[model samples]
Target: MRIFLIVALLLSVSFVAGCSRRADDRAPGGRVIVSYWEKWTGFELDAMQRVADDFNRSQDRIEVRILPVSQIDVKLMLATAGGNPPDLAGLWTFSVPDFAEKGALTPIDAALQRAGIGRERFIPVFWDLCSHRGFQWAIPVAPAALALHYNRALFREAGLDPDRPPRSLAELESMNEKLTLVELTRTGRVVRLPYAQLTPAEQRSHAFMIVRAGHLPQEPGWWLDLMGVWFGGSLFDGRRITADAPGNLAAFQWFRDITAKYGIENLRNYGATGGNFASPQNPFLSGRVAMELQGPWMHNFIGKYAPDLDWGVAPFPAADPAAGKDTTLVESDVLVIPRGARHPAEAFAFLAYLCQREPAEKLALGQRKFTALRETSPSFFAAHPNPHIREFVRLASSPNAHAAPRLCIWRECQEELRVAAGNALWGMATPEAALAQVQERVAWRWDRMQARWERVAEARRKEWLDRELP
Candidate 1:
């Protein structure tokens, strides 16, 4: 029935999408073809392919073909809605809730139990990332956690000890000021001055610009919305929206204060000088910015762009370092069997295989990442590409480590917070006012969504718990 529905829509979907299709039941060699759609490209994609090759070699029953697909989330949702989703897909763990809410995923609670896959097999944080509501929707393939990536060379240049990183946000802020350099350039000619040397009048003048910054809260600010995680607030408390929580207010105020410390116009001009994040011209790589919150994958880019960079990784300072000790943002890449898949059992067989100690370690190694499993082989660190991989692994296992909240409307809430952050950070509005508005709007949306979910909650719980690999 699902295949018939897919064929019915093929002409139009194909006309629009080049008709990307799921694999048939059998390959040329008569093995099951598990169509695994993925979003990774370049070396990252190659890593997953090698894992798939290993799985294929390990079994004669299934041939897992990993296909690189663009806009995979959008295409995946559509394909599942149209009843033709691939056997498996690679998605960010945050997407699990949204997909599950749409009835586009197969909950694998029974399959997991049958295969002896459980929370004990993986790090608790990675396991949690793949779960939504009361069901396990996916399995983590690779995990990541954010940390303070600082240039030791910049520290030495600023007369700070290279071995020591800021222990508190206040310390970080002080060091940021010391490392910052202001420029008084007119007509594109050059004059460099320390920010301290600028007169009060000059500080506010458009003529004076930030030539180098120690940190800009918005630079490479991928998790600006989740900044509250470090500040001891969360967007949701499982029942109500917490956008205007005191910690979140402080989080945004920190943004406002940071922006004010460096003049807004100066920071704006500094932004203009920013270069591509992946290239050598990246402010951090170029040594114009001294510190950033980044993950282990940064080492790969560092090697590709700035091999000589003297850098160190440590837990990013928190507002209250003692209370928020070891706090970090945990994120992961996950694999899922989309609803209406052609080969659910065989596809999951491949997923289960990858979750094993050996293959999980191999995939993580190939991607220059650490595995979701808690106990890593000693050789994993010995042969690891990044020398600081263990630090990331430690961060992920911290008591305060958090993944995105499992809300069906998280993307909407995230965008609202992003807008609020911009408004407060850029001085468009006071942090309190900006966040109050966000709270009002997102709460209304969340209430409506919760009401709808409440109506279907019972049925979903029954279905999600009872479904197995069909």
Candidate 2:
């Protein structure tokens, strides 16, 4: 009996060990875990997580862990500078150039080529924005463009058809004049400007939009490149900065006239009348203002905040009706592979998947954020249908959409332009003078940058010359 018991115990132990080994053999192995960071919080975060979840379940080789990091730009800068970046991160399109220039990113040309995805699959402007200094540092995931948002109630009150919106700036100005009212309070009469409440940042952004449309005067005022093109000023002889141009001067003059002579409201007083631009009680939403220049987010705002309000979305009015074709200014959120990444190749694989139009739409649909890709699934729009959402979706994917300048100096230039636009609106400086200062500053900075580039090029040329001569 004792011998039989010992044999039984040994057989049980051997059977258990064999089963454990078989289980281990069936387990999926060699997973490259990628740590990802993004700015999206709340709904945006949820959408991104859905994509990550899908990718994780699709295959076992790569496991993507999506980390939510608000204030993404500051976080990315600190992380990269500290030499400890995540495997993948979502960055703003503008910051791509800045990050790439500083060597904080790895180029994805080979990955893109390997995947058989080229520039043609994406919006040209957004693709160009990601390409800086001859390298592709990031991939655009979502794109937004500016458009005109008008209150239908205001249009009806002013004796106009809400469905038939303004096709020209002159018509819009006319509508604004009709909508303007002077409210007589007990103390005194207060001005109720129709198209008021735009911040200095918004105003300058609007000016940039207008300049792109070629309506603002041309020459070297404020941002001469914008004014230069509008005013027909030549900033460079195809090589160096040239500030002297009639186009620049005209742009400056136009800037001043639009703020002062026209019924354009002051940025300060306008803010008091309504909540912030994103709020439900925003000037445009609350009927305090008849029209506004806003992005695709407004679609969500209207659906969630003021569903009953009638509104129309159209492109920013062109300077020359014939010349300007419904152009949208494209901005985007990008996914990047940071330097020192633990799993860069895996990170890039996820990024490439994110850029795929169908999966991107699924994510956008889940989050309620707008789509950036050219081809979105029909169900995405069907699920979140606002009045002008389809129009925005159409514009977002359109070929005419353009990206704002990606030059490193763009931040400073934007700040200066904002200040100048405010000064012009408040009558602190004539539009022409205010814009002139901006142009002057840009010229000085541009010249300095050009000189530095020239010297670097000259040194490279000399090195090559010497090598060849020897």
Candidate 3:
């Protein structure tokens, strides 16, 4: 199946390139036409087009033609390999490492320096997302930070103060217990349990914090860096793999214990009741669940579907309050110039314009997303759709904010961790045993990837030497 997909991708790229070449020859005004592929749809697409239209009107030397594409990352890879890629693309931050290592992307350091866009202008975590292995590959446009969103009405119902959120793991757990209600059938079987009923995304976020609190070892080359940083751990120690570090084992065990305490079956039953996340029937909106971990986008859903819902947003509590205060996981959609772009300089010019304060804020507000910039004007905060925008911006600029594990195999590693977590949660394997399997599998994959890259480097070196000496 993978091979078939690869072949299909290459064929599509060839076809598209032919079409693009013809289109370029007929473009108006002899202006440098930069083709940009983005992954946004509907309103988001409109927002981006507004920015593009403004950029075009601002200068006549260059024109950015925005094209919305599905599965953009795959298409990007195929196009770049075929030697005909988009002038610029908007990609998930996690895709940077893979694209950079594959030689499909152009480093943006020189372009950024020429534009006088210093790293200090960006939120620290968002700025870090642009680089991999010491090379800047992309620039962040819309960044997000995770926070705890709780129903104020639920808090009052549980006899808890609506204003004071949990400050530590113990407090959060206690609040969860109080907010949770158990309903039973006539046969005494459990029917509903609110606290344990979380989406997979929420569950993963919780797992990350648990692992971090367990004091996981710093040098382990594990996949779960969002959790690792809290414990002062990194996913890699140079090129060495440390998947089976002592801290990771402890973290997995902790996760297993928490899962067991909640009763997996009950959690599963409650989770099955959830409706579409963006719909009116959403667990949080419908009052089926009292609390959730979500981004600012949730506000849009709430306002659209349940305007009367009383909710408050607060910083996600840490396992240890003193250690994890203000720490956040930052994610973003980034812009990059592909390797074979015909208008690299002009493409970068548009990128630089988008990164400016006004355009950045405009796009962010359009999507209800936070700006990647470190500072914003007072008007931005006041007019933002999200009432909690200030809190999110604060977290974005926090000293401890971090991006996810920046590795080429991050997606693969995340899948492995999910499987291991499932095994432990279902009691099919002991936490220690499940994590042991993860360590073995991930280490092997990492080693294999390293070998492949090394071989590529060697082949390139030999080819250069032979050509020069001959």
Candidate 4:
């Protein structure tokens, strides 16, 4: 709250210091320059840049200028507050709720209706992420979906069939047990043993370190709080925080058990021995971690760091009997026109062109991601950089697929839940206790948010409802 207040003060100051409107800048030939601020650099930038270049070549009325901006949310906040925001901003789907609620974004429903675009065009989960507060706020460009990526060699080493992947939580745990390795390090006497065979005393001792972890929940730790979706619950359901929901309790308990068995010191030692995520020694690439939940971007890292590593992708195993099949988390880089933009139509024109089948497929192929479009060109898979692109595409269309909650306090909720899960996983508290605290804290935050909304509801709704897009 204090940080928010500080930023709010900064925003008011910037508003008073009013800056030039860069979005209104025109080209030499009087073409409308649609300012697009994105955080993509390297080939990711090139992929979108190519799409922008194509759009410019295909039209004469508008030119989409792609500018690389770091710390997009902070920069975008200041720019929007200063009334000089870019015409279009490339942001993650997770950011929509907060920005939309703050009136920092222009709802795209009017433009979507004007263009005759509707839900039938894209995958449901991706399309859902673009909507919040009963309004369409953005359009997806390149989408990423999470799945379990396992080392084929490790499966074979553990006598598990390389062609078959675990489909349920129990099977995943069983396989994980078979694949785990613990090393006894005492006076240069090195011996490896199955973790299950270790006595409680040996398990608790610092004399051993886990050299291989089949699947450490904290390996990347990107989706800890969202794990409840697999167990059949969510963090927030429109009006309430469900941090201590039954499914979440099960999710965090499962986490606690894993953390307890693995021994934090052992796991930390193993993690210390591995290189950074992007490096060749990345636990997964080096075979330290046999399986992990990751997006299609992992293919690029594998190609660059561990070209010879044998790997395959599959939907993450479900932790529950119901609502668990084909479970996946999807995310995307989305395009939106900010609230103060001067060229909404022109910016959207470029977005429409890019969202079309050929260009969308082209952009996804370039970025090594998949398009949110319902249909892809026949040759898209053939040209895609990742051979497993189809799996992610299939997962994105899963009925169980989910994205970040559509709530203004999701960022706060995410952080709180992450810490709560950590408190359980690090043995500081039981899952029940940690999540209960989260439930109480988040409920209070939710109430505060509701109070603020009640105060601003009339004015904000009027602004959004009366806004024009032409």
Candidate 5:
């Protein structure tokens, strides 16, 4: 009886001591903090935070601290340059290429290989963009491709069936003409699609019109893709850009004709004022516009802001049904490891896990986000009731989905396009002049890029040749 009592007393004392030690060891709890930077805001941000919360709850080794950065490129560059980068980050795919080129990113291939993950796990085009100079750089999280979002109310009111949307670019033009309304006031002020003034429908329309006129390329090797289908010519010979090719000029001229006939307000300063897309005042939501070329997220915006507004989803009208084949632009959000991160291994492990199909789908659902890593089937979408939400996944999986050229000058390229379009819309330059200027700028940038690559390639070759073979 005496011995038992002594043993119990000893055990009690030990337990107390252990508890005290744990308490003393904690400095705001023994949480290993991992800082994460992401560009998503609004509902998109909530979704990302949920993923972080889930990951944190799943394990105890590390706690993720998410910082929502609005200007992703600016913040990320500053952090990297300052050598105090976040342990993990979420960035757009285009942003990753530049980071990888500048050595601001770390290669994650070793971690991916260790985890037995492969490129086959993600959508091919998204995966392709993450590779820079023969190294895997980042893990893809969400993919959003360009699709069609149309106002069904307008179609029904126009005495047309909303169920049947435009299938080709020609059909879209015909529908636009039918849906267009020109209300001229007694004061001689013309108001077309009065509701369009309520929202940024004109800007949205301009982007689609640019596509229809074929100013953009469908692929890197093709002559401007938008033109190849619209004007019937390729933009490249595989060796150089053929933006000024005969077919391309015709396509640009056709696009200029639209601006010449209509007012430029539709193209410029149309959508710049709207703060949020998911609002009742949205031009498309208000039924001021008949059609839109946007993404699946627009459906969510409508559900939250204007559920009563009838709408339908469709593929973006093809420039030329016979020639365009089903071209769609594929873009994605990715997780990148900044250079000189403190715990790169752990960061990459978490990223790799999230990039896998099952967990990715779960994270996606919980956050209402899309996945760049392709899901196995409809199991993920089947769980969600809205069919429109699945449109991005469907289009992303389609054969027509393709990534833009993985050039380092991609930033300049996008800038050129934006400026050219702006100038054309503002009446400062005709479509042909704007495009010709863009071509010239592109040619100069390409030359610089080629020179840079040649220098790097030559050095690498020499290094290999100079080394002794064992």
Candidate 6:
């Protein structure tokens, strides 16, 4: 807790220091200067800058100045609360609900319509991510979808067909067993175990895939939403919390079963021993891990560090063969217009320009990200760094694609869920106990947030009424 406070203080100080040197409200050329705060740096910053430059060149009315910042969520929230926000901000998709609910964001539905952009213009799931409750709060900039990446060499070594990736959970388990080599010393102590070990992000992707495959239930609560959807359960039937729904319990049990089979201790040990993920010695790249669920960005790492490594990308396998084949988890970075911006219209103009097919493609190509735009030129596919770009693009556009849960307390819920999941995996808590605790804690938080929201709404209503009457 002390560490968290210190980090928070540092972030606040950094944000204040950064904001002290504000950009001119108007450029020397008498153009409206739109301040754009983005959480991108280095190469990603350069890519966005290029897009900004293109927008500037395309018009003389507005000049978009991009500023990259660290701890963007913290800075953005502080700026909004201080009533000195940038005209536009690039934020994570999960921020939509909180920002919108807090009245920090300007709904973009009107702006989008004014700019002649429609829901049809973006990948559906990406578009949905921009909305919270009933209003559109952001625009997708760079989207990523999850897929299964397998080392072809490892498959061949296991005497498995390299071309035939697992199509069902059973097959995936079988392949995992065959691919995982357990070496034992003369004393019968285990030496090495090589298979799939997912990071937190990868686990989320896997959970979503299982939910999409109809193997688990999905509930309205972010933690168990996937399972609730699968089991026709609703975490909130619009009036109250239902975190301990029967389906959610069943889902937790399934999670426990999978963790037990995978051997939680083995996974923990393997992860501890794995090489740096950003380096060439990464388990997946070093052939220490046979398979992984990852995004298109993994292609960049493989191409740069392991050029000779033969690999294959496929849709994450379903829990059952009868489940749909193309389901995937989609996530994206989004641009939002914060409330109290000095130039909302001009900021949106720049945003709309960036959303154009050409500019969007250029940005995606520069960042090695999948384009958020629904359609792309053939040239984009041909020149994309990822050879399997089409596969990701297809998944992005698939009707079955789903985004992370949209809730004002999504971040907190996710954190609690992770803690519970870890505890369950380690046998510190039964899956049932962990999930019940999460449901209760998150539901309590949600109730408080909702009450605060209602108060804020009432205050706003009264303020507007007073203004109109006066």
Report the CA-based lDDT of candidate 1 relative to the real structure: 0.88
Clashes of 1: 1
- Displacement of residue 398 (Cα, Å) in model 4 is 0.8
Task: Quantify all predictions' global Cα lDDT against the true fold.
Answer: 0.88, 0.64, 0.73, 0.87, 0.65, 0.73
Error of 4 at 346 (Å): 0.6
Worst 10 residues of 1 by lDDT: 16-25
TM-score of each: 0.93, 0.76, 0.83, 0.93, 0.77, 0.82
RMSD of 6: 9.2
Candidate number achieving the greatest lDDT relative to the actual structure: 1
Number of clashes in every candidate structure? Answer: 1, 14, 1, 0, 8, 12
Candidate 5 lDDT over 1-470, as tens digits, reads 99999999999999977754322211256766777888877777787787778788888777777888888888889888877788788887877767876667877776678788887877788888788667777877777777667777677765667899888877776676556554433245544442223235543344222111111111111223343333444444445765667655655565555555444554333334333455676666666556766665666767777888877877775666665555566777888888867767667657866876777877677556577775555677777545676677777777767555566667776677556655654567887788788789987887887787777865643442332111
- Looking at model 4, residue 109 earns an lDDT score of 86
Which residue ranges in model 1 land beyond 4 Å of their true spot?
A: 1-23, 185-191, 196-207
Query: Model 2 lDDT vs. the true structure?
Result: 0.64
lDDT tens digits, residue span 239-280, model 4: 787788898898899889987777777776777797889999
Model 1: how far residue 310 lies from native, Å: 0.7
Q: How many clashes (backbone atoms < 3 Å, residues ≥3 apart in a chain or on different chains) does model 4 have?
A: 0
Instruction: Please give the RMSD to the true structure for each candidate, in Å.
Output: 4.6, 11.8, 8.7, 6.3, 11.3, 9.2
TM-score of 5: 0.77
By TM-score, the better pick of 5 and 6 is 6
Which is better, 1 or 3, measured by lDDT? Answer: 1
